[model samples]
Target: MKLSGLKSVENAHDDSIWACAWVPATENRPALLLTGSLDESVRLWRADGLEPFLPSPSTGHCLGVVSVAAHPSGAVAASASLDSFVRVFDVDSNATIGTLEAPPSEVWGMQFDPKGAMLAVAGGSSGAVKLWDTSTFELLATLPVTPPNQQDQQPPPRPASKGSTPGGKFALSVAWSADGRRLACGSMDGTIAVFDVARGKLLHQLDGHFMPVRSLVYSPMDSRVLFSASDDAHVHIYDAEGKSLVGAMAGHASWVLSVDASPDGGAVATGSSDRTVKLWDIKMRAAVQTMGTHGDPVWGVAFRPPGGAGVRAGRLASVSDDRSISLYDYS
Candidate 1:
């Protein structure tokens, strides 16, 4: 498989685009590309031509929008900002569905449950993953990423303490398993905490890189497998349940910022501080192709969810600090 540049938009955002997700298609519309930027706005684009879905950028966030997540049903989505608030809104109308806040904590990355029942946010400094009920938008639970001994302890009280928790696991990015039974969150110290979602407990910790792990994702076709990108400049694949490092792909010259598994489960794509995007073949554990289309560090890369009528071919999208968005044909 290879990636061919199809379309790229210069100045897609006024500032850095930090997050991207493919919103699945509803009965009335095809899937759309959702992006959040340091410009403090969230934008949606047509998957085919990169046309703006909204007349103007959707605004409400402050301190720049850092993360965006689409519900499985495609009717609603969520965006989080550095200001510590998550705005859940209707996809079509941009109507505010709900606003979520966990006092004294910052939001970094977010993902909706596979069944669209819950939304998980990586709670920075709170050292936990916060889950909210999607239906009622109520706070469901907080899964702390502390060590086994401190697992039962609550995160530092409302006004968070200055020092780090015993584990020092400041949650940065989060991903849910395909079966929805497991969840994983990456931390600043490069530790990955896997949790049993149903019990809201940390299952085990995976360690490899020494720097921050900024992004992670469970294989779309395998619940036991997980991939993580880190400031150490390597992408590590893990057998989450086994608590073992299966393999680590090293190629990026700088920090690997983001990673996503292809829908077919055969390959994974990564964006890096090296100003390049790479496609790594899982079976070979090596990069098959690299695209240096962005002039600045690439921040996010995502594969379009497989479903929508007449959309059989694969597509990948990447956003960067250069304020551009690029789409590629993945086949």
Candidate 2:
């Protein structure tokens, strides 16, 4: 229920680290940490020591790597950038598996389905979430995000001018439910779109924040529970199926950039522009501890996924704009 700093990697990247994920262990090796940064490279590190797994960082991404997702099998992973391309590569060999792109639509947040059969990508400006087949790397479907009906807006207010518009719903983040039956995506205008994957239908919209939502993740223990990080400087927990804002937590002094649910489902961790990472106790709905070790905005936080040989204790990681990566023990 608390975090203790274990290892710190100074200057882990030439620029800011925008994303991080733990690649589940395969028969050959233990779980490894994967990071993407503004330096236009993706790097792998040993989870225990933060040592670079490869001789050099993997390169080729342009416009800065912004998001990264590892396959459930841990054999392959994908990294997306502002350049509108998602490069799928082998985890061990780092060889290119396939390149995916939905022309004219930029890629943002991404997550592989629980079964590792599909990849869900937040399609910026396209106003949709794109699903791709993991085996063929071919486009599977696009679920468009529709603006809610005027009456759907609580207390229906008058429209504002162009200058005051909150911008269109450009999908900024995506997360798949535990069962892979549901998927939720966050947008530029602060709306969360929930979809039925099998039917490819937009179920409903979850409303609360009025600013851009940058990150989202489903609770590992509950399919209906969802958490989102937004520019409004708050983390909102929602019941995705019921379309209700179940709870809200506010403590971050600036925009919350990233969020992750702990393996046990008892707590969550968030990174903020306030240059700190906080651990929130889910039952209490409050921040139990704050770690302010980064000098710049903390951009990415990840809970090491459960399950690896003899890996029982919990581990957490945070990457920041200060060009550092820090690991913590959660117990």
Candidate 3:
């Protein structure tokens, strides 16, 4: 699939547009694109022309929004800010549904369970992942990261310096398997850890990136394949079950901030600090097209979810540091 730039809405947001998501179609209206910005607001837009649908302002976020997620049913969405707060709100009514917070760390990225029963937040600098029960908005569990085995038999002695440790795990991004049986989170130190959700045990770690992994997603069609975008300016495809890196796709001139796989798993879209959005053919492991639609860093880009009420073809939305949002027609 390829993308043809459809429309660009300048100043769609007041500050940097940091996150983007799509609310599935409902009987009353087609699917809508939801975006969160450094301006501390979450705005909704019509999918066709990127027109304003609901420009509701979300206050209370002390810092830039880092992530946004939609419930499978399209009734609710959650947004997380750099201040470590997760706000859940009704998608259609824009009513505040729930709020969650954690201490001594920041919340960077998040995703709802496939069944929409729970929410997962990447616990920044906390060396853990936090899960919340959606219905009650209560903190469920904190999954600690396991240290990887060092190649040397005797690893360097733990640093004697204050606040210095052999391994500093800072979770930055997260993803859920297609069946929701597994959860994977990437960290600032370039490691992807997998966990068996039912058992709540650390499974294994996938290694490849030498820099922070900022975004990750599973192929909607295959539960075992995972795609990750990192500050290393490369996308790593992993064999999730085998804990091996199968391929690496590189092209972005700067940090790749976001990535999403197409519903069909035929392609992947990425937004980069290079001020460009790219579409890559996964089979070829190369960027098929690049659209320089944003004047500043592109923070988020997402392919609209499939199987919404009136949506037959695919759509892509991108948000940027320029306080603008762009829409593209995917075919």
Off by over 4 Å in 1: 150-167
Model 2: CA > 4 A from native: 147-166
RMSD of each: 3.1, 4.0, 4.0
* Sort order, TM-score high to low: 1, 2, 3
Decide which is better by TM-score, 2 or 3.
2
Q: Give one digit per residue, the lDDT tens place, for model 3 in 271-309.
A: 999999999999999999999999888889998888656
Per-residue CA lDDT of candidate 1, range 1-331, in tens?
A: 9999999999999998988999999988999999999899999999979999999888888778888999999999999987789999999999999999865456878999899999999898878899999989898998887776965664443332212222356788899999999999998767899999898878888999787788999998989999999988999999999999999999999989999999999999999989999999999999999999999999899999998888898999999999999999999
Q: Could you estimate the TM-score for every candidate?
A: 0.94, 0.94, 0.92
Which residue pairs collide, candidate 3?
Answer: none
Residue-level error in angstroms, candidate 1, position 182:
0.1
lDDT of 2 by residue, 1-331 (tens): 8999999999999998989999998888889999999899999999889999889898968768889999999889999986779999999999999999765445888999999999999887777899999999989998887744632443322222111224576778899999999999988788999999999989999999888888999999999999999989999999998899999999999888899999889999999989999999999999999998899999899999988789887999999989999999999
Off by over 4 Å in 3: 148-167
